[model samples]
Target chain A: MTTRRSVLMGTALAAVSGLALSAGLAPATAAEKELNIGFVGVTSGPAAAWGTSNVRSMQVRADWLNELGGVKIGDDTYKINIVTFDDQKDPKRAIAGMEKMAQEGIHYVVGPNVDDGAAAVRPVAESKGIIYFPYAFPKELYTKPASNAVLGMIANYQSAPAIYKYLKENKGVKKVAFIAANESDPLSQRDGGVAAAKALGLEVVAQNDTYPNDTRDFTPVLTPIIRLKPDLLVLSGVSPGNAPLLIRAARELGYTGLISTETAHDAAVLKEGAGELADGFISVGGASTPAIRSKTMDEFIARYTKKFGEYNDESNTKVYALDYIIETLKANPKAINDVAEFKKTVDTFGAPNPYVKEGTLKYVGTTSFGQKRQLSVPMVVTQYKDGAFETLFVGEVD
Target chain B: MEQVIANGLYLGAQYALIALGLTLIFALMNVLNFAHGQMYVLGGFVTYTIYGQLGLPFVLALACSALTLAIVGALVEKFLFRPVIKRSAREESTMLLAAAIAFLMDAIILILFGEKQRGVPKIINGVFVSDSLVMPYDRILVGVIAIAMIASFMAYMQYSRTGRAMRALAQDRVAAQLMGVNVDRYSMIGFALGALLAGVVGGLLVTITGVNSGIGGPISIKAFLMVMIGGAGVVGGAIAGGFILGMMESVGLNVLREFGDVTYLVIFVLLMVFLSLRPNGLMGKPWG
Candidate 1:
């Protein structure tokens, strides 16, 4: 009995020592805490703009955070070191990139805005317990809780509903028509539009779906929509890639109606391709400029212009917002430990959405699960005018 | 509907100009010249460099890019395609390889120039408005230039000695060599002319579509589709195919809501339909 008791004690001691060793070697306890962050994007492809913009935004945010002395974790200053991987818009490549990042000890990642890359990276993020923030608006992300680590800044699939609300209540819009590609994931987002319109006492005049992202000429679908004479012309799933041509086609066909899109935030090329035709088009999403109030936005735009020679866009704001989150998390000593605890802090943490870099940011809630934010309000509608976007509606801070 | 048809026609002519070059190369050498789109983009870039930076005349920029592309084409045919033809086992693989090279070159362009679209100002400025239908004078100018280019191409092929040699080579390269044609020289010339055509078309495209490094792949794909659908073996077939596809795509989308993806689908369907029914394309002469 004595021998057995001693053996049990010895086993307990061994287990305790092993636990102590692991605790000592873990990533959190180091003097200068180093965090590896992975960024997955299409560093090359036709839609490379999406990736490049996001990368630049993240870089700017990181630089700003480090300037303010990195993410503070307890007593240690943890410097965020981002390692980016270019997925080239392929799902297989995106998966490989995520796996490689996970293998390389990346516990946190900012992601691909494109649908294919977003879908591929989500599973890997969940499997590895890596925090993945994607810029895409695929419904599967919100419908199926992949992981607590997986979160989107915006609820992408539900924008049409929000847009429909603004149109009906604010603009007195009664009739609407929809156009989008049938095969694309974003096209499914338009499905909510008809229901939303009907709920708001608006008639759905017509609906037409296209095949690919690059379909430019819109006469066939436009003729019917124009004939229907809907007050609001809704392009629910028009990507920046297709915006130029579709807008141009509509303009060419004498469409002088109020054309609105929820996905119009990133379509910068519309200014060049459609010129004046792109004017008066309003898109519901993050504020472009002037509308968003944040000093961080001003700094971002200045630095982005200095570095990239362009104004800040959605990708820029999102990454900047994330940087603020990371920095705020680091500042709170309670968030430095396990992943679940870190997420709870994130869900509850409220800092100014200093992402706009240009104006004042006021955040409102801890409801991160339902796209509720303590920092940002509903997306403001911005109209394209004189080669720049001007804010039309300021979102209410709830 | 008439307006849509007219618009499609104008767009179709542009496609035809680019497609004709691809068709010419395919007919003579049985190579698609996947880098045709890059050559077109390079033409625009070259023009931008000349007219915008160097302050040269617009016409000179257009001429210089065309001439330079023509020379480059000869060099490419001599170096890249000629060696491969000698050991031609996988023709499709070679085409795909060329496409990969084009992709690499496009990346180089993006890295160098950055991905912003730059416009070259129109040489002529005027508008033709017909009772609410307004067409830019540049469009009219581009259409005229396209017609002139087609006429010159046809005339050269029909009348010139070198053109006849290209025709003979197209008929049967081995047979042409047997008939005292220096096949290598003729092939080089054909490639050069094809490149020259691409350069000019590229220049013309910028007048409407603006120039960006990333436009090559999509443009190349469109050109390829046009050549395949309209026919691939003859110069006329390429032009006809280009115009048909271009117009169809431009106006088809306006007519059909799902027209964007349909354009690509229609091309493949036409290709399959044509292969089973009329294998040589709509205008391609039968090769034996």
Candidate 2:
């Protein structure tokens, strides 16, 4: 019943009619809008794991939130989208990454993972009205006249003193020796730890023990430090790659004392590289321990590990940054485009913590940063066993 | 002080193993081989995959690492470096090719390995501590094994037919070719051997220090320092340079404890002064 010419004409006619109808009705119903958040950090270098974890946490939470029909803000509901840039752990690239986010009209951004990166993007963030959450611990970025940056996690200075005080009271630790990789990040953390250690009346021994970041053999580096026999040996801002090697070398050299760091570490890496050598290693654990995890947090961990093959322990703190961004925007929708309103809202902001089982989410650091520019993170210290983290204690930032 | 020597010995073993591979490629090809460290990283990952993930024996993992690197090295020379060396007017142009190869290998490694810090379980463990000398049993075993490998390589070079041919080619490429040697085939084999050495060292050291994609560049820079300290193409010089660096690090960190951040500065100045006095290093001749 159908001829070749007739079928061809009929197909052509249907195509034309469909296009005409869509074009004619295009003006009345508009396309839906989605919110964009940016992540600019070191995702391709030695410090890559932390930045990558930050992005994944942001993505996992954003994806989960979007599946819930998006978040309701004012009278409109919008889904979330993530933008990412790899700064390669360089400061110049970090500035460019910030400029790119600004070009895309993204108001809220997360990270420039290290100290120099966070500092380099400060000017761009201020001029472009972007609010950035960084893990770097620089007082100037959080201090007065610097209003756009917020601390995403606990600074080493804040955690070091708390850890040191607990050690002094419980473990009978009276003397301390500090060692850091001879780089800007670790050196800065070491200096802060030194000041904190001295303030707590703990004697400082062998504070000048620093090694080049590339040194594989800590034998020469740790030999002198071990001779001092300090009750506590503090590895300030040690990267995950170096942690196991350091612990192994120290233990091989007969170091019987306790070892600790302020940065979170991967328990699996510790087990594979250091084995029994890393038995008593202490580090900053997750932002929320198992005792404090909400149902949302458990679901997030399941989805993240499923998507990424494995999970980075540092994600415990990074998972909170995006949700806070969304929640604050919900509190005052005007802050979505205007950072001034966000600043005002941040001062009086108090909401139920989304990832934690209990307690309220609010900005602290009014005294430490001279503004409420830091997220109030639960400080959970953990000790490394075979291939797992056992919670040592949980304390809140003063 | 004795403990410092013990530490230096262990450190020297690692430095020597790393330097040998770089020096061999330089001697054979006159190529700067910037990608040598990436090959080393590839070797480490191969071993990690075999032993750490697949649950194979450590020896089999190491053997596969060596075999994989040798084939890769032979192919790279056949296609990439060999063609570039032929077409370029200046020998220094090979350095550009080497740099490009380094970038290529880095990208390849990143895609495959995913930038994770990978390691294997220790093959042997426990410490051997006596009278202020605290040496891990693994370090002692590794040092002995490295020394044996070096000695075996020397014997092979002195006796084996392929080794003699390769050495003769290094000494005089045109003359060796005229003496009925297959220049192209031997040259490719020589490069493969050099890369194989890198793989072997990487496999050995991965047990001690974890490996990742980001470590490749720094390892190359350190290899360059070792090669410079030694005579550019001399194998014996590489060994000497390794010991010298190891002892310097041990002494600099322990004896010169007060210098803190500036100890490396002092060491660098001393090295510069030494190099200024002897431009050819301890063993290099005028031409080499």
Candidate 3:
């Protein structure tokens, strides 16, 4: 029973079984070469849903591409391997994650999802020639002299003006109030939204209502904000988790004003947290609603839910980042390592968006960052009703 | 102003529930349990599973959460803390262990519960509106439950034999041992009680703000602030600290609404100044 031949056979069988078990976890075969794409972001902590969505979407896409016999770049076909790093929402760890990605020779990265992490990894991404698509909204990150960082989705400043103008024009909204978490991301977004509100000539009734991230009770916070009695209340850059709480608090306090956020929100979460109270709550609800979702989008949602056992609506926008990376690399194979080449193709590069039937994949942000440094995520603002999102209006990023 | 007081009282009731468990453990063992927040989170998640997922009654879910956390606390005290304490007399060792435990619990929480913010259906419907004062019925129920729990805990600690033994141990561990009090059993019980209190608060609060793995650390930090303000290891002081922090937050947020989000910073500064004057806190004496 303990013979060397038997043990060797057992080991061989075990190795084969292990490989078979890890079918979707890694590239299924050694026949195909691998192209490593890095994801460095907070996969844990309070802002987890955002980064988690980013990672899951990329992984599903990578697996899908690999299943389709890999992506072609220049003359070679390489299996897309997503390398993930959980920075735990710490900027220092995000830097370390970027360094680790660089050491692995991965040139394209998906995220450093928050403002601090996005800023922290800038030195590493630039120095290492890593073209990172960060889901962060710092203007400095996407502006000139910051060539490598691309805005992964529509930022608050970009989304707010579109949302505010629509509401003002449609709902006759005159007064706007802004509230934010004391954190940098929310504070920045709040300030950006305030500027946008002022630019639209909407009267700023309340501007500096902020609370700590860990605050559970919002009655005290919102009472003062509600007293201003603006026609609209905006929670700037609120995390997906905190949005419902703020909404619920505001609504329960009998403030009949319309409430909105420029950040992503989960309809299911809103329903569960605020119930029927969250009806008419507006937020950036990604690029598609059930009404506008294409076949490809439906398939992606089904497969993602099957694989990960859950799907966040935020992932609808997140899938675009990796798709952009792979498509850009195919356009200019040299950009696999050099971000400058990627930049050169940004204005000219165009492809059919896989998520939508009639949508074209292109770069935007000419108006926001003075360059095509943002993905043209169809700015779909939505209102939460029951456990689903109803598309309010779809605007294009300038 | 009425709204501020109402908010404070509501906030204070919940905060007191959280601080009770933390202060109780600190009183008996002087272990500044960094993992206390994780325990509370664990409780919330457990309740969520039972109530939100399994469709169990809310009362049953709360009870299960309490039971689960008590067992967890007892095991932690018996295996981790007791072993570490017997092996080493250093306070830093226990502190390190607690931090390690917090990280470990966070990891476990991530693995068991995905990073999604989990919430339950509103236990009750309707709103209570009287002039400028607006409060939800669910919130009122939670506040009442929290106050009831605190009162029950106080009564138990006063009337119960186990409570008296725990008090004796907290007063003087060595002296309690010499007086034929079973130190190890009582210590374990105290730790369990502390963890149970945390669980109860977590379970109750999950109905309101929801629970995520990420909130544990912050919850613990908040609990620490309450303990510091009220005086560490002082149960009454912990309750007092909770109410004080709650009142300050309520008043500060409204009064200084025009001053941006500087309420917490101002409170922190004021607290620091207060601590400098009375190092033992308002009601605490050293480890009180």
DockQ of each: 0.18, 0.52, 0.74
Compute each candidate's TM-score over C-alphas.
Answer: 0.83, 0.93, 0.95
Measured by DockQ, the strongest candidate is 3
Report the C-alpha lDDT of model 1 over B1-288, residue by residue, as the tens digit: 655666667777777888877778888988877888888888877777687557789889889989988988899889888888888788886697678768876887778656555455556665665663545567768878887888888889888999889999988888899999999999999989998998988876665655677678777888887777666777777777877776666565565543334655665676787778877677767222
**For candidate 2 chain B, which ten residues in a row score worst on lDDT?**
B279-288
DockQ of candidate 2 compared with the true complex: 0.52
Off-target runs (Cα >4 Å) in candidate 2 are A1-30, B285-288
Instruction: Order the candidate numbers by TM-score, best to worst.
Output: 3, 2, 1
Model 3: lDDT to the true structure: 0.90
Q: Chain A vs. true chain A, TM-score per candidate?
A: 0.80, 0.91, 0.91
Could you tell which candidate, 1 or 2, scores higher by DockQ? 2
True contacts kept of each: 0.23, 0.63, 0.85
Model 2: per-residue lDDT, tens digit, A236-320?
9998888888999898888999899998888777887788889989999655467777887788889998877787777888888
Q: Model 3, residue A151: displacement in angstroms?
A: 0.9
lDDT of 3 by residue, A1-398 (tens): 49999999999999999988788566656557789999999898888888999999999988988888889999999999999999988999999999999999988888988999999999999998888999889888988988888889988888899999999999999999999998889999999999999999999999888989878778889998888889999998888888888888998998998999988877777877788889999999555697677888999998899998878888878989889998988999988777789889998999988786568889988888988889888888998888889999988886
Which prediction has the highest TM-score against the true structure? 3
Q: Write the per-residue lDDT of candidate 2 for residues B133-210, one digit (tens) a residue.
A: 888888888888888888787677668998888787777778889999998898899889889988888888888787
Model 1: DockQ vs. true structure: 0.18
Worst 10 residues of 2 chain A by lDDT: A24-33
